[model samples]
Structures are given as structure tokens and as C-alpha cells.
Target chain A: MKAWSIEKPGSREVLKQIDVDKPEPQTGELLIKVKAAGINRTDTLTRQNAALKKPYPILGVEVSGVVDSNQSTDSKLNAGTRVCGLVNHGGYGEYVVMRADRAMILPDELSFKEGAAIPEVFLTAYQTIYWLGELKNEEKILIHAAGSGVGTAAIQLAKQLSQATIFATAGKPEKQEMARKLGASVTINYKEESFDERINDVTKGTGVDVILDFVGASYWPMNLASCAADARWVLIGMLGGSEVERVSLSELMRKRIALKGTLLTPRSDEYKASLSREFMQIAMPLFKEKKLQPIIHTVLPFEKLPEAHRIMENDENIGKIIIKMNQ
Target chain B: MKAWSIEKPGSREVLKQIDVDKPEPQTGELLIKVKAAGINRTDTLTRQNAALKKPYPILGVEVSGVVDSNQSTDSKLNAGTRVCGLVNHGGYGEYVVMRADRAMILPDELSFKEGAAIPEVFLTAYQTIYWLGELKNEEKILIHAAGSGVGTAAIQLAKQLSQATIFATAGKPEKQEMARKLGASVTINYKEESFDERINDVTKGTGVDVILDFVGASYWPMNLASCAADARWVLIGMLGGSEVERVSLSELMRKRIALKGTLLTPRSDEYKASLSREFMQIAMPLFKEKKLQPIIHTVLPFEKLPEAHRIMENDENIGKIIIKMNQ
Candidate 1:
């Protein structure tokens, strides 16, 4: 089996393709023949020797594949059942091993590329909006970087579960329309005008009930300001920076907002299981109903992994970039 | 009528007893002859020239008094009714005007000084524990500055409402005992013990569900480390300082914690009204049943305003320090 392993993490060059023995499924696990995998900023960070307590990691967090083998004799899944999940460590391999609970039955209507795109972003957005944000149809959410994979999914999920008002942000005018098309009630081009100004103007200074932020610590202040009284600010990523500069607690206190930070990879298996159960219950139905669609920006060959990483790093792509696993 | 007023913002010595026209009740308002006013950190901040936007620069926030006059014809309250409530712009005078909606009937068992002690602290504690903390009977909450007025109230309230585990932090051993007597299962001498060491040892590293932090930004990291997987960090004051150092959001993400900073003073009339209403509904019965009692540390003469301010600034008193009107 060929896997992309990080050898002495530094940059994209550190991602090395080497032949390795195919991993076998442990008890309560599945051996999946990887069909596709998605690239994320987390991969970049883990590759750059940042925010890793564990090292020599595989680079993919989301993957689409077929069940090649099951470890548990009593496993319910069939051998060829289509699946998508966080492949225990990550996806960048010809065959990835995952906990049986981590695997979700990929919707029949969706493609392998779309299935690969679904797991990471949707789970993050779901955890942010429902678990922490405590969102309802009566509420409104501000999705920052609405052109991104998580942002795109968040827009649709908010509309699906809550059918609530959504405010999204994009860096370019073209991206703003794309976000709007994805289900944003209001879209603001952060390049031309401040999203905060637009938020205040649109919401009549009431602010949004929830803010799903991926821009990281730099957007901390604006995210706080953009929240309504008793708002929830869920941080899924810190692309811009890590430290929030001069955090005004006075503002957070006045609004009674919750500033929550999250990392999916490091979370306990129990937590991931709970998230998967949610995906199985809520998102699966929505997918079957054709109410939700995975936003795949590009589907490149597995060998073009470096290009995929560069595209995500450049922040030029609006949705998930999938790499087909050459089995 | 005579009242303690600060013509210009400066020190405690600048506080003066001056003759002024008594405030009259407006529509839906009550003119109360203040019997006792709780001396709080808000009064201290106002004295230190904390920029206030209110039209009238009155130094008080919570007062217990006899109704001197009433303008709300339909209000259940009448002249001479004993009540306690949140004050409007002006409260540190012979007669202070307040909305009838913001007032609550004082329990017959409680004295004016005790009644005055209850409002500010109870409001802070109740909002922090129930509304923001989302505390459950089985869960534990960590209260910082546990000897302070709000901390005292939170301990009693959490004890009264449900059988929740409480970890309290106070500066002195004596304060720890007092907090323990008030129902804190464990009291850490914050001045001595590393709360991080004790908290980790106690929860077996699971941490607390909610953190009531009024110590300001200095306690930020401690609060984060002390919190559970889904922890809620509510900030009410900055006694230690507002600038928090080393906010590692990675910890927040890994734990899925909600770090929120809050202040009680700047809330809109609606929020204050809601607070008053909820307090009345949930806490009134507890007060009537004698399950709740206000902890008054000292009762100083209104003329001794400077001394009261000094006591508060030095953190000399336990619970609340109330200023008697007609001493």
C-alpha cells in the first residue's frame, strides 16, 4: 500500500509517498480501500510541525472508500458498503483503517468525491452550530469564510436544520455570490467593506446569534462584536493567527457571548462517535432528501497531492479539494 | 435632602455629603427613601473615573428602601412598601427614582441591609450559574474570589437550587472556611495552592463544568485548564487585571470550552427586568423558605462612604458591605 507520510515535517516537500504494509482492521474497526481523500488547513499545520503532540502523521482527515474488510466478526456493514470518515489517523493512503463507528454509510445519491468532502467540514460545522451554538430556526448565524468547505456546508446545514437566517462572508465579490447561492441570506465581500459594518447595518445592530469562524484569532474581535447578546462564537480554525491581540473582555461580558475553540483531530473517540451518530441521524436524512449537497471544488488525481495542498494554502478554492486514492 | 455625590471623578476623599433636590417619581417609577445601599465594585470603578455614559452620574446600583412616592398607579407597590431593586441613574441620595418593574418585594425575615446585599450579588451569581453556566445538579462549578459578594451568593444559590459540586477559591484560609461553611465542597486558598494542581487532582483531570471568574484576565488560563470538556468561562470583573496572557486557543478547541466575559452593569433595561423577574420566580420562594440568606460583612454609615469604598478596594470585607442611609 502507498501512503503519504510526513517525514521530518517542514513543508509540502515533507509529504513523501512510500510503499507500506497495508494496515489491518483492529477489533471494532474496518479496513477501507480509499477511493478519495480531502485536503484541509489542519493537514498543512500538522505537516509544518505545528500543533502536534504526535508526529509522523498521515495527512488526510476526510476520506471516501469501500469496506474492504471488517475486524469484528459481528460487524453489520457489508464488504462493499460505501463509506466516508476520518480514517483513524488520516486519509493519505491507499487503504485507511477506521473505527466502525467512525464510518458513515455514504448517501447513494452522492459521489465518492462528494463523500470524501462530507465528513470533516460537515462534522465541524455541525459541532459548531448545533452542539455549541445551540442554533434553532428562530436564530441567525454568521458564517465567516462562507466560500470555504466548512462555510459552504454550514450555510446549507443552518438552512436545513433551522431554516434560519444566515450571514456569510467572502474575500472577493465573486465568492460572495457563491456563498449567497449556497444559501446565505446576506453576503459581504470582506475586501471592499468590513463585515462588522455590514453585519451591524444588516442586523440593525442586533448582531447574529451564532458565528462560525475559521479565520482564526485575527477575526476574534470582529466575531465578538458581530455577536448578538448571549451569542456563541465557535472557532473551528485559526488560519490567520493563533493569539487574539488585545482581547476586549469588556465587550464579551456586555454581550454575554461564548467564545468556544475546537480541534476535531485531537478530540476523544467518544466525542467523535457522538458526532458520527449525529451525522447518521441528521445529515444522512438531509442528504437522502436532497436537501444537502457536498461542495467539491476540484477532484484531482492522487499523485497531484502537492497541488491540492498548495491550492488550499493559497485560499483560492471555495470548497473541498478531493484527491482520488490510487488503489 | 442630603446625599453623597462626587462632582468630579477622583478618589474616595472626593465623595461629599451635599444638599440636593429630592428625586420625584416619573411614569411607572417609584421614589424610594433609601434605607441601605450596597457598596460594590461598581461604585469603586465610578469613583476611579470609569467613563460612564448614563445621564446622571449616581454612584449606586442596588438599594433597599421604603417607598417615598409612586407614579405607577397600577403597580402592586405603594408608598411605604419595603422593597429592594436595581437602581436607575441616581441611587446614592435621600430619594432615588427607579422603575417599579425593576423592584422586588423584600422578604419580611430579611433586614434592609441584608436586602440591599442580595440584589447585586444574587443577580450576578444567578445569571452566571444558571443562565450562562448551564449548571446541572451532578456537575461542578469553580468560583473564583469565593469570599466576594457574588461568589458567596453563587455558592448558596448553587447549593439551594441543586446538589452540585462546588470548588471555591479565596485569598485567605479564613475566607475558604467561610466559603466552605456556605456550601463550597472544596475551598482552595488561591493565594497558596496552585488551583490548577488542586482542581486537576480533584476532578481526576476532568475539570469543572462551569467557571465563575470575576478575577479578570489574569485567571484566564487557570479557568481554561480548570474547565471540563464542554466548559463555560464567564467573566464578571477584572480585579486581577483585564489583560489575559497566553490564551492558547488550542486548549480551548481540544476541550470544546466556551470562554465568555461578562459584566452586569451595562445590560439593557429588558435584560435587567428579565433578571429581576427570574430572580423573583426562582429565588423568591427560596428566600421565603429561608433557604437563602444575604451575607453582610459590615454595615457602615452613609456618611462613612469613604471608609466603605476603602474596605471594598482593599477586599477587607467578606460578602457585601452595605451603607446605612439614616445612621
Candidate 2:
């Protein structure tokens, strides 16, 4: 089995392709033959040994694969069944073991590349927007990083499921246009104008009811200023920066805001399993119906994994960048 | 009618007794002849025109009284019916009007002072601990300002309702003892030792599941250090200060903590009515059984309302400070 592994933590140059023995399925696990895998910002972080606490070896967190061996109680998931799931790690390998409960059956209508793109971003978007953010029907939502994988997924889901009026902020014009096409009622190029002021103006002073904040410190002041009373702010990523100077708790209190911080990779297996079940039950049909499409920026051959990382590092991709693992 | 009102925003000297016309009940409202009133920190803030948005004439928020007039649709609340409720304002007067839906029938076992004490602090505590915090049975909770009115009320409610393991932080020895007596499993004299270190040591580094924070800026670091993964921190007050010099969003994400800020005063009439209804259903029976007790530090006459404000300002009292209106 060929897999990408890091001997030591550093730049993308540290990622090494090597032959390794295939992993065995443990109890309540399935041995998956990787067909396609998704690249995420967390992969870069894991390569640097920043967040992923596991011993360095494989990098990917989400994959579309075929069940090679099943050791779980669920009879529906048989060997050779097509599936995609969120893994603890090792998705960049030929053979990766995933918890049986976390695996979602990939619909026949979607390709492996599209299936690979759905788990990480879609589940994260689901978790942040619905579970943590508690977005209600006809509410207003402000989604930052509107071009990112999770951002695109969130816009579509909020549009299809909640009927929420979407406000999006993206740096690139292409990203802004994509966000608008997906669902955003108002799109702001954050580089050109302040999103808070624009959103405030559009809303006629009352800010959005929910905010999906990916840019943390850089957007904190605006996020604070852009919340309606009893707004929910879910922090899924901090791409711009991490630390904010002079944070005021009084403003949060006055608006009665709920700020929740979350990361999909760090969540427990049980949580992932539960989230997968709920998401598949609700969102899989939408994918099958082509109502919710997986937005892919590019799909690269497995050998071009380094290029995929480079593209993401440079923030050139509008949505998910997938790696066809078997190619 | 004689009432305590503030002409200008200032110290306790500004709280002056004046003659005012008795208020009449509007639609869905009841005019009550006040028997007793509860003093809170918000009352002091109202004296200084801090949080309350209403005009600066009255100085109280919760009272227990007999119904003088009813323009409300509720058939049970007739004239002279004993009732207690949260008011938008005007609880310090000889007569006050409150939304009928917000009023609760006083249990025969409780006095007017006891009823007065139940509305504001108990409701706020309930909202913070159970509603926002989502504390489950046997989970550990850390309650700050353990001797303050809401703190004492929360200690009692969490004890009787969830059977939670309570850790409390207080400045004075008497407050600590009162917290213990109410139901706190452990009490920390916050003035003497670092609460975060003690809590971390006790939980074996996992920290508490939920925290009720009243001291804001001063407790930010300690509160961050004292949370378990997926912990809920509800900020209901800012007794210490409101600004933090440096805040790390990454740290909050790593812990997956939910920080919510709330003030019961500014919530809408419908929200107050709903909260009052739910609280009465769940907690009133326990009060009738004497399983829940309102801890009162002193009962001062209406003329001595200024002294009550001074005592609260100086942080001298233990539980709720009640003003007996018709003494």
C-alpha cells in the first residue's frame, strides 16, 4: 500500500510517499480501499503536527472508498460497498480503517471525487450552522470565508434547508460571485469594504441572527458589531489570526450572543458517528436529487498530492481540492 | 403613592423618595399594590442608568404584591390576589403594573418577601444554569459570586433539579458556608486562592462541565482554564470588569467551549412570560415543599431603600436584600 507520510513536521516538502502494510479493521471498523480523498486546511496542520495528536504517518481526514473488510455489527455495509466517511486519520493511504458507524453509503449518482468532498466540509458546515449555530427558518446568516469548502456547503445547506437569507464575505471576486450563485442574498468582497457595515446597512441596522466565522481575530470587531440580539456565532476556523486585543464581554452580554468554538477533526468518534448518521439521513437524499451539489475546485491524481497542498496553502481554491487516491 | 425614584444617574444619595400617581394596568397587565420588593445589582445599575433602557424614574424590578387592578385576560388573577412577578420597571413604588402573563400565584407557604425574592434572582439563575448552560444530572458546575442573589438561587436550584456537583467561588467565609449549605460540593474563597488551580486539581485536569460567570474580565483566564471539552460558560453579569486584554479564539476552539452572555432585564415581554411560565411549572412545587429556600440577608423598610442600595454597592450582603414596602 502506498501512502503519504510525514517523518517530521514542517512544510509541504516534508510529505513523503512510501509503501506501507495495509491497515487491519478493528472491532466496529471497516477496512476501506481508498478511491478518492479530500484535502483540507487541517491536513496542512496535521502535516505540521499542530492539531492532530496522533503519531505522524498519514494525512487525510475524509475519503471515498470501497469496503474491503467489515468487522462491525451493521449488516447493511458489506464488502465491496461504496462508502465515504470521516476518519481519525490515514485517508491518504491505499487502505484506511474507518469506524463502521461513521461510514455513509455513497449514492450511485455521485462520483467518488464528489463523494470525497462531502464528508469533511458538509458535516462541518452542518455541525456549525445547524447544530451549534441553531439557524432557524427565515433567519439571517453571515458566513465568512464564503469561498472555502465549508462556506460553500453552508450556503447551499442554509439555502435549501432553513430558507435563511445569506450574507457572505469573500476576498476574491470569483469566490464572491460563487457565494452569490450558491445562495447569498448579499456578497461583500471583504478586501474592498467592511462586511459589518455593509451587512448593517442591508439589514437596516439589525444584524444577522447567526454568523459562521472562519476568520477570527481579524473579524472579531465586525462580528461583534454585526450580531442581532440573541445571535449565535460558531467559530469553525481562524484563518486570518487567532488572538484579539481588548475583547469586550459587555457587548456580548448586551446582545445576548452565544459564541461556540468547534473543530470537526478534534471531535470524538461517537460524535462523528452520530453526526454522520443525522447528516446522511437528511442530506444524502439532497445530494442524490442534485439539489445540494458538492462544489469541487479541482480533482488531482494521487501523485499530485503535493500540488494539491500547495494550491490550498496559497488559498487559490474556491472549494474542495480532491485527490483521486487510486490514480 | 410614595415611590423610590432616581432623578439623575449617581450614587445612593440620588435615590430619592417622591410622590407619584399609582400606575394603571394596560392590556394584558395587572396593577399591583406592592407588599415587598427584591433589590438586585441591576437595581443599582438602573440607579446609574446602566443596563435598563427605560426612563430613569423607578428603581426596582421584582416585587410580590396584591392585585389592585387587572386589565389582563387571565381569569385567575382577580383584584387582591396575591401575586409576584418581574416588572419592566416600577417595582419600588407603592403600586406597580406588570404583564399578567409574567405573574405567578404565590404559594400559601411563602411570604411576600419570599415571593419577591423568587422572581428575579431565581429566574436569572434558572436561565443561566439550566436553560443556557444545559447542565445535566450529576454533571459538575462552577458557580461564581456564590453569595450573590442569583448565585444562592442557582446553588439551590441546581441542587434540587439536576443533583449537580456544585463548585462555588466566593469572597467571604460566610458566603462560602452559605453556598455549601445550599448545595455546593466544594467552596473556594476566591480572595485567598486561585480558583482555576483548585478546580483543575479537583477534576484531575478535566475541569468543570458548566460555569456561571458573574465576574467577567477578572475571571476570563481562570474560566478558560477551568473548562472541560464541550463546556458551557454562561456570563450573566460583569461585576469585576468587561474588557480582556488578549483573547485566544484558538484556545476556545480547542476546548470546544460555548460562551453565552445574557441579561434578564432587556429580554422581551414574550420571553419573560414564557420563562416565568416554565419556571413556575418546574420550580414552584419545590418551593411549596420547602425543598427550595430563598436566602435573605435583611428586610429593610421602604424608607431605608437607599441603605439597601449602599449595602449592595459595598458588597456587604449575602443573599437577596428585600425592601418591605408597607412596613
Candidate 3:
């Protein structure tokens, strides 16, 4: 089996295509033949940080593949069934094994590349927006990193499922435009304007009901200022920095804000399986009906994983970047 | 009517007994002949802080009294009915007005002082534990300021309702003992030992599932370190300080903690009414059955309101301090 392994930690130069033994399906698990895998910032961070203790050297968390074998006889999944799901590790390899309950059958309407893009971003967005944020139909939401994969997915879900007013912030004008096209009621180029001031101005000082933040520390004060009373601020990533300089406890209490920090990868298999069931029930139909579409920036061949990492590092992609196996 | 008013802010010396007009019952409201009232830290803070805009000049927030009049015909409350309820303000008076919906019929098993102590502390504890924390049965919880009003209430409720292991922290040895008596599995004198170290030792590094915190900024880092994965840290007050020195977003994300800041006073009448209903349904029965008891530290004459404030300022009390209205 061919896999992208981290030869040395730190930078895209460390990523190398290497041959590895294929994984076998365990009890209640399925062995998958990788068709396509999505590239995420977490993968890049895992590859770059020497201190991060990873279970495997391979770098992928989500993959779309064909079921090669199933260990559990009663499992709905059988050999040759196309599926996409979250993997604990080793998704960068041509062959990987995943828990059967966590995998969802890929709809015929969706391609392998699209399926690869759906699991991580869509599920994360779904979990954060619906489960953590508890987004209501009439509520207003501010999504940071609007051009990123999770950001785009959140926008589409918010638009399709709820009557929420979407506010988005992106680093570049083109990215802001892309966010606007994707369903953001208002898009701000964060480089050009202060999002807090923009939110205050646009909402007439009412502020947003929920905020999906990836940019931490630098945006903490602004995020607090931009939130309405009883607002939920769901933290998914800390792209800007981690150390919050001075958080006013009084302001948080006065505003009655709920700050929830979430990470999907660290959760148990049972939890992910529940999330998979929910996503399949609610989101799969949207994909099949073309109401929701996976936004792909570029699809590179599996061997060109380093190029995909470079694209992500350069922040040149509008949405998800995919790595296609045998392309 | 006679009421205690703050002539000036910043000290208990500013509190003075003054003559005021008795408030008439408004629509869906009750005019009560005040029997007893409970003193809370919020009352003291409102008295001391010149900047905190209060609804009225009165000192107390919760009172036990006889219903003198009921304005709403549909209300279950009637003249001469004994009730304990939350007052917006003016509870430290000969007479007080409260919303009929917010008032609960007092069980004959409890005294006026106990009834006065129950409303604020028990309601706050219930809202924090069950609603905000979403505490599950058999989960471990850490309660700060375990000798205080809400802390004692929480310990009793958690023990009675949910099979939770309660870990408490207080400044004094006697206070720690009181916490243990109330239902805390372990009590740490925070002055002598580091609570985070104690928690780590006791739980064997698993940490607490929920932390009900009143001491804010100073305990921020320690609180984060003391929490288990997916912990809910419900912040009810900021007695220690408001400015958090340095909060690591990464740690919050990695632990997947939910940091919620709550204030019960500023919420709408409808919201508080709903909470009152829930407390009546679930907790009132426990009080009736003598399974849960309100812990009262002392009963001071209503005229000695300043003395009550002084005791609170010195942090000398083990449990709730009540003011007897007509003694």
C-alpha cells in the first residue's frame, strides 16, 4: 500500500510517499480501499509539530473509499460498497480500516472527491452549529474563516436548514466574495475592516446570536463585543493564537455567553458513530437533492500530498483540497 | 414602610434604615408582609459598588412573607398565604412586592428563615447544576466557595437528586468541615493546599466533570487544569477578580470544556417564572420530604442589615444569613 508518511516533522518537505503494509479489518470494522482523502489544517499541524504524539505517521483524518472487507457479518456494509467516514489514523494510505458504525454509504449522486470533503468539514459544522451552538431559526450567526472548509459548510447548512442571518469574515476580498456567494448575508474582508465594528454597524448594536470562531486570542475581545445577550461562541480552532490576553469575566456574565471549545477527532468512536447517523439522516438528502454541494478547490493525485499541504500552508484555497488515489 | 437603603456606595456604613412608601401590587403580582429575608453576596456588591446600576435602593433579593394582597385574579396566591419568593429589590423592608409567578407556596415543615434562605441559593444552584452544567448521575463535581449560600444548596441538591461525588474548596477548616457535612465527598482548605493538586490526587488524574466556580480569574488556570475532558465550568460569580490574566484557548479546546458565565438576577420575569416552576416541581418536594434542607448560618434583625453585610464582607459565615423582618 502507498501512503504519505512524515519522514521528518516540520514543513511540507517532510511529507514523503512511502510503501506500507495494508491494514486488516478488525471486529465490527471495515477495510477500505482509499479513493480520495481530504486535506485539513490539523493534518498539516500534526505533520509540522515534532511535539505532537500521533498514533500513526500517515496524515489524513477523513477518507472516501470502497469497502474491501467487513469483519462483522451482521454489518450493513459489505465489500464493494462505496463509503466515506472519519478514521482514527492512517487515512493517507491506499488501504485503511475504520469502525463500521462510523462509516456512511456514499450516495451515487456524490463523487468520491465530494464524499471525502463531506465527513470532516460538514460533520464539524453540523456538530458546532446545531449541537453546541444550538442555532435557532431566527438567530444571527457570525462565521470566522468564511472561506475555509468548515466555514463554507456551516454557511450552506445554516442557509439550507435554518432561517439564520449569516455574517462572515475572511482574510481576502476574493475569499469574502466566495463566502458571500455561498450564502453569507454579509461578508467582511477582515484585513480591510474590523469585524466587530462591522457586526455592530450592520446589526445596529444588537450583535450576533452565535459565533463560530477558529481565530482565537486575537479575536477574543472582538468576539465578546460582537455577541448578543445569551449568545454562544463555539471555538473549533485557534488559527491566530491560543493565549487570550485579558478576558473580562464580568462582560461574559453580563452578556450570559457560553464559550464551548470542541474537537471532533478527540471524541470516542461511539460519539462519532452517533454524529455519522445524524449527518446521514439530515445532510445526505441535501447532497442527493443538490441543495448542499461540497466545495472543492483542487484535487491533487495521492502522491502529490506535499503540494496539497503547500496549498493549505499558503492559504490559497477557498474551500476543501482533496487528494485523489490512483489519479 | 421601613426599608434599608444604601445612602452611599463602597461600605456597610453607607447602609441606613429609612422610611419608604409601601409598594402596591401590580398586575399578576403579590404584596407581601415581609417575615424574613436572606442576605446574598450580590446584595452586598450592589451596596458597595457605586457603578453597578441597581433597580432599587433596597438591600435584599429573596424574602419569605405572608401574602397581603394578590392583584391578579387568576393567580393561585391569595391574601394570608405563606410564600417564599424572589424579589427584584426592596426585600429588606417591612413590606415587599414580588411577581405571583415567581413566588412559591411555603411548605409548613420549613420556618420563615429557612424559606428565605431557600429561594436565592437553591434556585441559583439548581439553574447552575441541572440547566447549565447538564450534570449527569454519578459524575464528579467541584464546587468553589462551598461554605457560601449557593455552594451549600448545590451540595445538598447534587447529593439528593443526582448520585454525584462532590469535591468542595473553602478558605477555612471549619468551612471545609461544614461542606463535608452538607454532602461533599472531599473538602479542601484552599488556603493551605492547592485545590488542583488535591483534585488530581483524589480523582487519580481524571479530574472533575463539572466545576461550579465563584472565584474567577485567580483560579482560571487551576480550574482549567482541574477539569476532565468535556467538563462544564459554570461561573456564577467573580469574587476573586474579573480579569483573566492568560487563558490558553488550546487547553480549553483540548479538554473540550464549556465555560459558561451566568447571572440569575438580570434575566426576564418570564424566564425566572419558568425556573420557579421547575424548582417547585422537582426541588420543593425534596424540601417537603425533608430530603433537602436549607442551611442557615444566622438570623439577624432586619434593622441589623449593615451587620449582616459586614459579616458577608469578612467571609465569616458558613451558610446563608437571614434578616428577620418584624423581630
Candidate 4:
């Protein structure tokens, strides 16, 4: 099988197309023929990490494909069944092994490219907003990086499922407009205006009940200033920066804030399986009914995998970027 | 009626004994004839707060006494029924008002001083460890300020209810010994040794599952270092300064830590009532069985309330400091 593997960790320059043995299905696993793979920031981080050895695992972490073989006889994920879900690794290849329970059946109405975009962002948004953030109906949520994959998914999920009032922040006009179109009641150009001031004005100084913070250190003070009493803050990404200086713990105590930091990739297999199952049960029907849609920015061919990584690294894409594998 | 009220927000000199009118109970409320009152750090903080106007609210927030009057006809509480509870204010007086639903029936085995020690510290500990920290059986927990009121209460509750592995940190030898006696598996003298290093050595780098932090800024880095993945850290106090410099959000994300800051005093009446009912139901039996007991350091006469505040301000007391009102 043809796969994109890093010879040594550095940049896109280290990426090389090489021949690798096809993955085999273990017990309770399914061998899938990759149709489409989604690109994420985690891939770039893995590429830049010096600790990863040569022949580094394939880049992507999510895929949409057809089950070529299934070891579990009782499961519905038999040969030729279309599915899409997160993987431990090795998604940037012709074939990959997936745990049977983690796979979400791809609906007939959606294409493989769309399916590839659904798992990582939607599942992350679901886990962060509902499971961790505990967002409720009639509550308010402030989602930063509104143009990013998880940001877009969170806005949609918070809007459709919880009927929450959504406040979105983006650096660009196009991104802010897109966020507004996707059920955001208010959108702010973070580069042009101070979001905390805007939040204070809009909320009448009470602030939002929940915040999905992707920009960490750079936004800490603003996030702190924009939280209501007993607010839930879930940090999913630190895109702006990571080092925060002179933080006052008393402010958090006074407001009674709950701040949680998480990454979906490092979770255990059992946790992923459970989250995937719950997400599929609740979201699949919406996907089939066209009430929820996966936002895709571009679909690059298999040979243009490096280009896809570059697009994501530069933050030029509005939503998910996909790498389509030729049959 | 004799009452102790702060003339202004200052030191012990500001606290003066003055005659005030007896409090009256409203609907679903009880008029408590105060027998004992507990002193807390919140009382000292209120004394130091410069924003408070002249003739500030009475010092105490928790008391144990007999019900002088009960307005609720259907409730079990009647005149002369022994009770202890948290009050909104005016606890440092001959008479105070308590919500009928928030009062706990005093067991015959405990004295008025012991009952007074139970409300503030025990409720804070239970809410922090169980409600917020979510400590489970077999999980490891690190409790800071091991000799303090809430610290002692938390150690006993975690040990008795969840059977959790308890790690306690305190500045004084006497405090450490008291923590050990209360069922802490490991007690570290924080003044003598670095707690994070000691914790690293003991847990073999896995760190604790939950942490009860009262030191705030001074312990932020150490708390971050000592947390295991998915650890729940509840911050209830900031005794050792509140400003922290140079915090890394990436570290929190890597560990997936959940940090919550709360103060029980600011909670709504409904929330307090619910928590009080739940705590009474689960813990009252243990109190009756002699399995749970409140720790008291000193009991000063009501007229010497200023001395009690001084003792707490100096951090000289081990457990709760009580003010006993003569019959």
C-alpha cells in the first residue's frame, strides 16, 4: 500500500510517499479501504515533534471508507459496508485497521469526503460542549476560532441540539460571516475589536454561561473577564499561545468557573468507542435528514497530500480539508 | 440581645460587643437561640475587606443552638429542638435566623461546640471533595492545609465515605499528626519538603486523581505538576496569595485536568437547602455511629470573639475555633 510517512520529524519537507504493508484486522477490528482522510492540526504537530522516530505513523487520524474485512462475525460492519470514524493512526494510507465499535456508518446521502470531515470535529465538539461544557438550552456559549473545524461544528451543535445563544469570534470577515450564517447570534472580528468588551456589552455584563476556548494564553484574561458565575470553560486548542503571566486565582473563585483542558486524540480506546457510539446515535439521524452538514473547505487528491498539510498549517481553510484516495 | 459586630472593616480592634435587637424568623424559617458559633477564615476576610460600610454584618456564619421558634407547621422542628446550621448572617449574636430546610438535627452524642464546628468546615469539605472534586473509591487525593478546619473535615469524609487514598500537606508537625490520625495515608510537611517532589516520588510520577487546594498561587505550579490525567482540582481558598506568574495551558491540556473554583457562601438558597438535605441524609448516620466527628481547636466565650478572630488571623488554630455563648 502507498502511504505518506515522515522520514524524520520536521516540516512538510520531511514527508515522503513510501510503500508500507497493509494493516490487518485484529479481534473485534475491521480492515477498511480508505476513500477519504481528513487533515487536522494534530498531524502538523506530530510532524514537527522531534521525539517521533523515522518511519513515523501515517499522518491522518480520521477516515471514511468501506470495510474490506471484519473479524467480528456478529457485527453489522461486514465487508463492503461504508463507514467513517476516528482511528488510532495510519489514516493517510490506502488501508487502515479500525476498531469495530468505533466505526460510524456513513449515510448514503453524504459523500466520503463529507464523511471524512464528520468524525474528528463533530465528535470533539459534542464531547467538549455537551459532555464537558455541559451546555444547556437557553444558555449562552462563546466559541473562539469560529472558522476552525471544531469551532464550526460546535456552533452548529450548540445551535441545533441545545438551542443555545452562540457568540463567535474570528480573525477574518469571511470567517465571521460564515459563523453568523451557521447559527451564531453574534459574531465578532477579534482582530478588529476586543471580544471581551463586545461580550460584556451584549450580555449586559453578566457574560456567557460556557466558553469554548481554542486560543489559550492570549485569550485567558479576556475569557476570564467574559465568564458569568459558574461558567464552564473548555480549552480544546491553544492556537494563539500557551504561556499566561500573572493569573489571579481569586477571580476564578469569585465567579466559580470550571476550566477543563482536553485533547480527543490521547483518550483511551474504550472512551473513544463510547463517545463515538453516543455521537452516532444522536447525530446520525440529523445527518441523514440534512439538518446537520459537514463543512469541507477543499478536497485534495492523494498525490497532493503535502499540499493539504500546507493548507491546514497556514490556517487558510475555513473548515475541514480532505485527502481523497483514488480507487 | 448581646451581639458582636464590626464597627468597620479592619483588625480585631474594629470588632465590638454591642446590644442589638433579637432576630425574627419568617415563613419556613427558625429563630435559633445561639449556644455556640464557629469562626472561619471568611469571617477574617470580611473583617479585612475595606468596602464594607460602617456597622458591618455580624461576624459568624455557622451556629449550633436550640430552636426558639419555628414557623413551619408541617416540619419536625419545634421549640427547644436542638439544631445546627449555616446562616446567611448575624450568627455572632444571641439570636439568629436559619432556613428550616437548611438546619440539621443535632445528634445527642455531640456537644454544642462540636455541632458548631460541623457546619462550615464539614459542608465546605463535603461540597469540595464529593460534589466538585468527584473523588471515588480507591482514588488518590491530596489535601492542602491538612490542619485547617475544612482540611480535617475533608480527610475524614474521604476516608470514611469513599475509602480513597488520602495524601495531606500541612505546615506544622501537629497539623500533620492530626491529618494522619484522621486517616491520611501520607502526610507531607509542606514547609520542610517540596510537596510536588514528594508526591512524584510516592506516586511514581502518576500523581493524584484529585486535589483540594487552599494555597492558591503559591501552590499552582506544584498542583499542576502533581495532577494525574483527568484529575479534578477544586480551589476553595487563596491563603498564600492569589497571583500566579507564567502558567502553561499546554500542560493542563496534556493532562486533561479539570480545575474548579468555588465558595459555598455565595450559593443560592435552593442550592444550599438541597446540599444540606443530601449531606444530612448521607452523613448523619455516621455521626450517630461515632464514625464521624468534628474537630475543634479552641472554644472562647462569646465576649472574647475578638480573640477568636485574632487566633484565626494568625493561623495558630489547628481545626475549628468556636465561640460559646453562656446560657
Candidate lDDT scores, in order, read: 0.83, 0.92, 0.90, 0.92
Better of 1 and 4 by DockQ: 4
At residue B10, give the lDDT of candidate 1. 75
Q: What's the C-alpha lDDT at position A50 in model 3?
A: 80
Q: Which residues of candidate 3, in runs, are more than 4 Å off?
A: A49-56, A73-75, B6-10, B19-21, B49-56, B73-75
When 3 and 4 are scored with TM-score, the better candidate is 4
Clashing pairs in 2: none
lDDT of 4 at B177: 95
For candidate 4, write residues B1-327 as lDDT tens digits: 999887788888988888988987899999999999999887888888999886578778999999999987736799989999899888999999999999999988889998999988999999999899999898999999999999999999999999999999998889999999999999999879999999999999999999999989989999999999999999998988899999899999999999999999999999888888889999877988877889899999998898899898888899999999997
How much is the lDDT of residue A238 in candidate 4?
Answer: 89
Query: Could you say which candidate leads in TM-score?
Result: 4
- Residue B184 miss distance in model 2 (angstroms): 1.3
Question: What DockQ does model 4 achieve?
Answer: 0.89
Question: What is candidate 1's lDDT per residue for A1-327, written digit by digit as tens?
Answer: 788877677887877887888887888888889999989877887789755554476677778899999885645666888988875565888988888887898878888888899998999888889987899776989998888888888999998889889988888787788788878899888777788888899889999999888877777767767889988888887767777666667777778788887777778898898899887887887887778888888989988898899898887798899999656
Residue-pair clashes per candidate: 6, 0, 0, 0
Model 4 earns a TM-score of: 0.97
TM-scores of the candidates in the order shown: 0.79, 0.96, 0.95, 0.97
Which segments of candidate 2 are over 4 A away from where they belong? A50-55, B50-56
Could you give candidate 2's per-residue lDDT for residues B46-140 as a string of tens digits?
68865544356687899999998989888899997999999988999999999999999998899999999899999999999888999999999
TM-score of 2: 0.96
